[model samples]
Target: MSLDYEEFNALFTQFERTAIHLEMRDSYGTAIELPHMAKWATGEPDDLAWLQDWCDLVREGTQAGKSFRRAHVIGEPLSDYQRWSHSIMQPHIDAGSEVRWVPRRLVSSIAFPGNDFWLFDDRLVVFHNYAGNGQIIDFVTSTEPADLRLCKAAFDAVWPLGIPHEQYKLD
Candidate 1:
């Protein structure tokens, strides 16, 4: 079912005790807080250490069998995407967690077909669509898987086509 903006915000605010899966397109920001942790993910640059800390929390949660997944699509060729995504994801990769990146085409094929994209957690799944006047309509669901596997598949397919971050020397 669909939820209005306020209802969606309330549901997200109350979702601290369960696993969450997120499918994000375009760009946005989210503030996530767990028992002893809190984090912010956006298109902007965040402290690397802070992201590492969250990765650790997620790892601990995983060990105890808590489900958590985040899938992001790179819509721009901006360095910020690479930097932030890599920083937030490096720790998980180091610990052998499955982190995936999907391209726009694949994501569009699987998504609900709109502009603002989707966000899914254990409490609710939000389909955010722009109303053409800076307003948004959120379609929420409580049963979506966050679909990280499909996103991963798409990433695996696209990663090889892009330049490795290490080799990219931006002036």
Candidate 2:
């Protein structure tokens, strides 16, 4: 089912054990992110003060014994957005979310879900639908056993292949 923003954000706080995100896109055009990305492109420094909300959520979740992990299946010679994302990742890492990067070529053998997603506790999945221009269209959530299995398996298969954020370098 499709989820509104509030409903989607609620899942982040409500998950009991873990939250796993698998990002397959090399770029995104999130409206809120454009300004930050533009600053990066111009070589301007970012205080990253805007990320406080998410950092706080991750900090609280980890302190509560919940785990958050994200794996990005990215191509070599990263897109501008991904490069900027990597440069500004220290705060999220410091906030307790474990982020990793997987080279796309290494995952050619494993099948992946059609869209990027977050799997909460290996049970619920929130798929992010995007337009061709990388603008988010909507979020779709699923609780079907098949979907759960697919997402869980996909993430598991990708996780071990990822290079930790600190070690990953732009190509």
Best by lDDT: 2
Residue 142 accuracy (lDDT) in model 1: 38
* Model 1 per-residue lDDT tens digits across residues 89-158: 5576554344555445544445332333333332334555544433444554434455433433443444
| Candidate 2 Cα outliers beyond 4 Å, as residue runs | none
In TM-score terms, which candidate is top? Answer: 2
Pairs clashing in candidate 1? none
User: Model 2: per-residue lDDT, tens digit, 17-62?
Assistant: 9999999999999988999999999989889999999999999999
lDDT by candidate, in order shown: 0.45, 0.95
TM-score of 1: 0.44
Task: List residue ranges in candidate 1 displaced over 4 A.
Answer: 1-20, 29-47, 76-79, 95-97, 113-171
CA shift of 37, model 1, Å = 20
